[model samples]
Target chain A: MSSVAIDLAAVNKSYRGKVVVNGVTFTVAAGECFGLLGPNGAGKSTIVRMILGMVPPDAGKITVLGKQVPAHARLARAGVGVVPQFDNLENEFTVRENLLVFGRYFSMSAREIEAVIPSLLEFARLGSKADARVAELSGGMKRRLVLARALINDPQLLVMDEPTTGLDPHARHLIWERLRSLLARGKTILLTTHFMEEAERLCDRLCVLEEGRKIAEGEPHTLINEQIGCDVMEIYGGNPHESIELIRPYAQRIEQSGETIFCYAPDLDQVRKQLRGRAGLRLLERPANLEDVFLRLTGREIEI
Target chain B: MMRMTYGAAMPANARNWLAVWRRNYLAWRKVALASLLGNLADPMTNLLGLGFGLGLIVGRVNGTSYIDFLVGGMVATSAMTSASFETIYATFARMHTQRTWEAMLCTQLTLGDILLGEVAWAASKALLAGTGITIVAAGLGYAAWPSMLYALPAIALTGFVFASLAMVIVSLAPSYDYFVFYQTLVLTPMVFLCGAVFPITQLPAAFQLVAALLPLEHSIELIRPAMLGRPVGSVGTHIGALCIYAVVPFLLSVALLLRRLMR
Candidate 1:
């Protein structure tokens, strides 16, 4: 119980009688990074909001850092940090003023916030832009500033929803590095991302949700292994239906989407060899990744 | 060491509404010059154009010059527009466009605390608008010095009344477009009907009954006498009416916001 940072057991939520989250359960051990991966309207935001104590679940219980949620939400939120999906920076204030103002939300006085501003700016690599208006900063700088602002209280757990969604590769890598440092210092992170590469890289364990139900939960590697086997042959730019028909016999599982057919097989080399001389086809064989597991579980078809 | 993490746990916040107010204050500071001028523009035009243009046709009203009679009404309505505009435009931006309030909710603050902060901030802005006109009135010698200061509490309470009322509309508003109905159908009509321009007695009997029910009428009643250095009347009833406007809509707004946002 002491080691568990967040526990949502049989949690259920509904909106206007529409079941948004139905009997979902997960636990994040302290000092571990947990990822919640789902497509749009799969109830990811609903679950995140409930955990932050914004909405009460229709059924089940949620405890965060040992405090009951939506009841002790304030006490729980006081110890938690959040990096929202959007940067949501205050454009009206200077970069430094943004951090200064946020401290007061935690009941910290201006003077206390002043003492922390310099160090927080340094953490964000934004010391030079301290007095600059938020509108003046680049997208990357604003994101970093938001990341630094979330740490004003030095929370025990950090809840980040799509923290690096719109950043360029250089910026996203920088954010990833900052997150790695936070994790190294023993902060438990609850992450939700559509980036399978990010989940593969950063998440120690993750859960995939389909239509508000927990479809699969395990370590990324284990999920890839169990759901998608060892390798996948991605055949694209030909005819996916015909490519799928040709590879269906040897592939463990085949999912065709758009112009690409993902053939997940225990031995995809056989499929690769068989397609060696096929005309008008593009094929690449690689180790099955988290994207393969995610696609296999949630399916490649568009969901509303 | 410059290690700036303040991880020390503390008691839950009780007065962090001030924090929310301070944020609005900081945000407003950037556009302070333009906004103050905007608030001044409405009453200034009415004071010059209507006070002179319309005042000539209608001579002394309530035993005073036409423009002087309008002074008290202008002060009351300045607060009305200030509180209403602030609540509808600025507060709505924070809630919808900027998502500032949404970010605030992610912190230790509750919906009630944020609402209080918005109310207090709107009231403060209304107070500024009301005071600007009061100073101009005193400068023009239409209002008594220091006595006009007595109207300030009434000004603030008017702010509370209208700002909270606007918040109720804000809680119900689906988008920026919905605010126009309240602005035109509700607020713009209140100006003409609430005795902000002419006396309610000048209004028909049916209109007077409505003017009696609205908070602005009671406000102008209290504030006009105070601004003119006249002996005020109906003190208890007026204050009670204003208090009802301030408290009920405030409570209703918080409840409605909890329903709209928390869901």
Candidate 2:
């Protein structure tokens, strides 16, 4: 109990009777980087809002940092930092002013805010752009400023919803590196992301959510090994109707796309042998990943 | 030295409320400037065009110059219009297009903080614009020096009342065009009929009853007597009415903002 940072028990939330979240129960261990992986409309934002005390759950208790949410949300929030999905930087102020103004809310003295400003700028590599207007900064720079602003109060728990949602690869990697440093310093983090690779890269343990319910929960490699087979072979086109007919004999599990076929089997060599005899067919084998786990557990296609 | 990561750091959430205010202030500052400038333009035109142009013909009211009648009206007009603009237009944008209030709610800030900060700032802007018009009025010798002191605070409170009222409108408003309906159907007619431009005695009986229900009628009536240095009575009644105007909408706006934000 002492090591638990966030505890959600029997939590349910409904929007105009839609029941967006139903009986979600989980505990985020202190110093653990936990990830919630799901598609859009999977109630990730709903749960995040509930934990932040933005909305009261219909029936349940949410405790953050050992205090009940919203009721004690002010105190709980004092120790928690959040980076939202869309960057909400104030366009009227300079990048530094945005940070300074936010830091003021935590009741930090001017000296203390100033003392941390330099280090924070250096941490996010935004030292030179402090005086730049928020409107003038590039998308990546604004993102970094927001991250730095979130760290101003030096929170014990950090919650970020899709932090790298629309960023390019380089910008995303920069955020990843900064987050890893935060983890090394023992800051507990609750993260939600649609990126499989980000979950695989950053999270210590993750829950896969589909339609507002947790379908699978485990470490990345463990989930891939247990739920998904070691290898997958994607077969494309000999004929539209007869495509599954050809691979069905060898494949233990066969799933069809519009014109392509996916054959999941324990023995890749046997599947390859059958595919070799047939001409005008394409075959590629790769290791299984979170996308495959999502497919196996949620029974949904990997649109990406 | 053993470096502490966050050694009993000042809790960020305490400041969360202020951050929400800062966000709104920064978002609306540009619009506030434009609105203030636009409002100042009206009085400046009065100072240049009406006070001078029509001053030669109409002369003065109660031995005071024509510029005098225009000055008090312009000061009251600026305060009313600026406060109304802040609430109606900018509040709508924050609620709808900017999605600013929604973004702020995701933080530790409560809806009450946002409302207080916004109302305070909007009132401040209206007072400042009122001051500018007053300065011009003083220079023209229409506004008395002592009256400026009392009238400034009065207009500030008046602006706050309207700003809060606009917030309520934004909360209930469904579309941008709804503002036009509000300004045209509700605000424009109210301002004209409220004795801002003419005396309430000149208005018909039905129009006078309608104007009495609106806050601006009381606001202009309260300031007009003071600007004219007339002995006004029942000061308590005016203050009470204005207080109800400001407080009711303010509370409603906070509640509505909280509801929308929580969603």
Candidate 3:
């Protein structure tokens, strides 16, 4: 078995007598990208804060990078880097100044910091804007700088909370590409995002959080396979009752949306064969995705 | 490019404090030199306006020129103003708008480290500003070299005390508007009535007792006597009062901030 970088046992957290994280437990193995998938107010950030020892868990224990949390928290955090959801860069500093200043926290000498900064900037694809003030950067540029700042200490574990939040598609793809590079270089990453596509594309393993509890855990494809069927046929612009009756026999699961009906079947070809005789039905067949797994798990559409 | 604790064995608190100072130094060096230079404009205005303007009216008090009399008080006032604003207003913006402290806490830094770092940095800025004011005061023949040496520690003490008090304000403050209440109601009253612009003896007895309890009053009292060539009355008592003023609020603010952050 691979060594665990983050280990939690029956962790519980509460705010003002209301329990948020209720007896949650999980482990993230070394060199793996573990994604926490949740909707808003799902207590994802709270759990991440506890793991980083920013807040102490009310009950149970957590360990990161082989050190017990909230006790040896400093030691644990020494090897950890974080990219918060908000862009929290110092506006007065240039991009290079921001990186140089953060390097000082880890006691990196000036020459050493100078040497690593170019590579770090290149890693974030922000090499050209190094001398520009952080205030002058775009939202995407700021996000990339935050990521580059997180890398200054050469952390063993990187925790990113909604790292691609509020970014354009191009920026999101760029961040994902950089993250993939980091993973390939054997960096352990813990990420939280509301973007199912992001989780599908990046996570080696993932867990869905609902109201502070782990509702589902597995690989993205495996999750869809177990919770939702392999194939789903979305039938819109047809009579709902007639469509359900017609497609129900061919599907493992049938769901409806206003005027449309969705049928999930193991074999799309067989389902299509059964629907061949039905007229006035516009049918579209596609493979199940993380959205399907998410809806199956929560019975609600995923949003920020 | 990373080193562990700078090759010295240190306690956990010490190590974390160093990290906090490291982060603060990084942050301060990014902005403060310019900030200090900007703040020098305030005392220069005071020297130019208050010293020359008011000097024409009052002429002298306690055998010293009005320009000389006002320079000591202005230095203390600037120190208080800089330290208080640095932590209260600017710190509030960082806490709420920027969320910098929230991110910093996610690292190895503790609440104590943050508190110390901010206070120390503000104190350092106050010292630099105070030094500039002193130089300007000396050039105007308002201060001598002895008072300059005394002013260094005085400015630092004044800044430390106000920075701690402002941190307490930061702990309870939720918005930028709240800082206005602090400045208008609390800081304004103290600056006006706390013997900075004038001696506390000129105030009524009830106001005198109130001023005695204030940190700003104590700061002005501690620094003013030395500048005026007075005996400075029991150095131990002055040190004790200033330390208490700085320490009590510092400990309280740290406790409150730690609870807010860690909980």
Candidate 4:
């Protein structure tokens, strides 16, 4: 078995005249959780598709596990699991049948699949709904079913595309907990997510992409520390820009969005001193996080 | 010298397609009774209405009673309709609406496997529909038993041919409504001109030429004689034509779908 689960070298892809992924390269070590984080149309889907061998990258090389992709993709996929971006459960089947049919696609016998169904249902918290039709399940239940279905083959590397895009806080936290358990069992995970918190909580190391190019790559806290510093000061309401000059000397980076001004620094002593008795301006100081890092790197504008 | 190479994984595995076929078979089994009855209802109506009602007026036009003459055509029509409808409607839902094929693609199965399994399932349904009508005709004393058993191969071949052709239509169809054109332009015409209810010889010379080209016409050519306990002529030619219809369209559907969806 190869220690490297996935490796990409100078991969390039384009559709018609427009470039989608431009010379992006990354490697995922065995049992390491790697994330591909980018805004919409940042070529995240194209890259993922290339890795899965669904589409041939126009240029560059890709290897998943030990097989060169789009050539030995079937052999490679025989050991990989994928949770797609949306809930596409087999609607006609019951929860157990859904898992059975998916396992069949992997060439598993019914007896073999039946052997694993109970444990997987327990893992998904869908043990009670074993015979329930897919439509009878809630959105969270359906999402969990898709997750459980992906594990039918007991894959070595799990690729998840936005695993928790729409879910209640409780369901989201449960899925996160399950993912943590998967990691604890030494399963490698490659995730693409729009949620900064999801990427922060799950990914051991991640790459941030912007307009088909990699802009930043590192650990969540390390990137936050290197770019935005230890503390972030927010000034809400009032003329927050007027205080920018006051706090500029102490702040390493300052940005203004709408009626709020953000100040990042090692500490808020200078901001606290300068903004003292600033009247209507409400100032809040907290530890900087991954969202702060993401916004600073990708910009606030919604990429269409 | 320039290097020329392309890499596209088209792993052709029989086991993979069998899995797809098994999935569809399992699902279809839930509604199998209703579906078979629905297919029967159409042909049964035509047989009783045209065979008995019209046969009373026509008497024996072709050396046999019109009711007995119509049994073979009805069997062929049932096979074609069942296979075509299953491919157009059920396969369409799996590919476009439910995104079932998309889900299967994420697994170890390839596009080829998915399509082959889908068409094979449709063909199986066709086989059942055709065989059902034959058994019904035999029970009603309209067809001979030992001779009717010979029609099974012909009926099975018609299933493959129609299922393959319908899948080609499905691969090219944009939405549900696009199927109306295939129904109107291709299938409905075949019914009237392919000797299902009437002999193609009664038509103008040009239409006879057209009817002779249809796969359903060849189907009836093989099945009618067998059901009537008569000699089947040009057996190799009819079988060859049906084989072309089955193999060509199936391969075409596979290629067309690869171009359409895999991109």
Best by lDDT: 4
lDDT of each: 0.86, 0.76, 0.80, 0.86
> Tens-digit lDDT track for model 4 on A1-304?
7899999989887778788889899999989999888888888878887788787777888899899987777778888888988888988789999999999999999999999999999999999999999989998899899999989999999988888888898889999999999999999999998777888899999998877888888888789878786788888876766788888999888877667787887768877888888788888888887767777876563333
Candidate 3 DockQ vs. native: 0.36
TM-score of each: 0.93, 0.90, 0.90, 0.95
Question: Any residue pairs clashing in model 1, and if so which?
Answer: none
Interface RMSD of each: 11.7, 11.8, 9.1, 4.2
Point out the worst 10-residue segment of candidate 3 chain B by lDDT. Answer: B1-10
- Model 1 lDDT per residue over A24-51, tens place: 9999999889998877788888889989
Ranking by lDDT: 4, 1, 3, 2
Give the runs in model 4 whose Cα sits over 4 Å from its true position: A276-280, A301-304, B1-11
**Which parts of model 2 are misplaced by more than 4 Å?**
A240-252, A302-304, B1-36, B46-63
Tell me the alpha-carbon RMSD of every candidate.
5.0, 5.5, 4.4, 2.3
- Candidate 2 deviates by what RMSD? 5.5
In the range B103-174, model 4's lDDT, one tens digit per residue, is 888888887788778878888888888888888889999998799999998998898899899999998999
Better of 1 and 3 by lDDT: 1
Q: What residue pairs are clashing in model 3?
A: none
DockQ of each: 0.37, 0.25, 0.36, 0.52
Show the lowest summed lDDT stretch of 10 residues, model 4 chain A: A295-304
Ranking by DockQ: 4, 1, 3, 2
Candidate 4, residue B155: Cα displacement in angstroms equals 1.8
Model 2 C-alpha lDDT per residue in residues B1-263, reported as the tens digit of each score: 11111211112334344554565666556577775677789767866687788888876555666666666666776787678787777766765676565555544555666666667767777888888888777776778777666788788988888888888887777777777877777777776787765567777899889888877777776776677776557677777888999998887776665565555
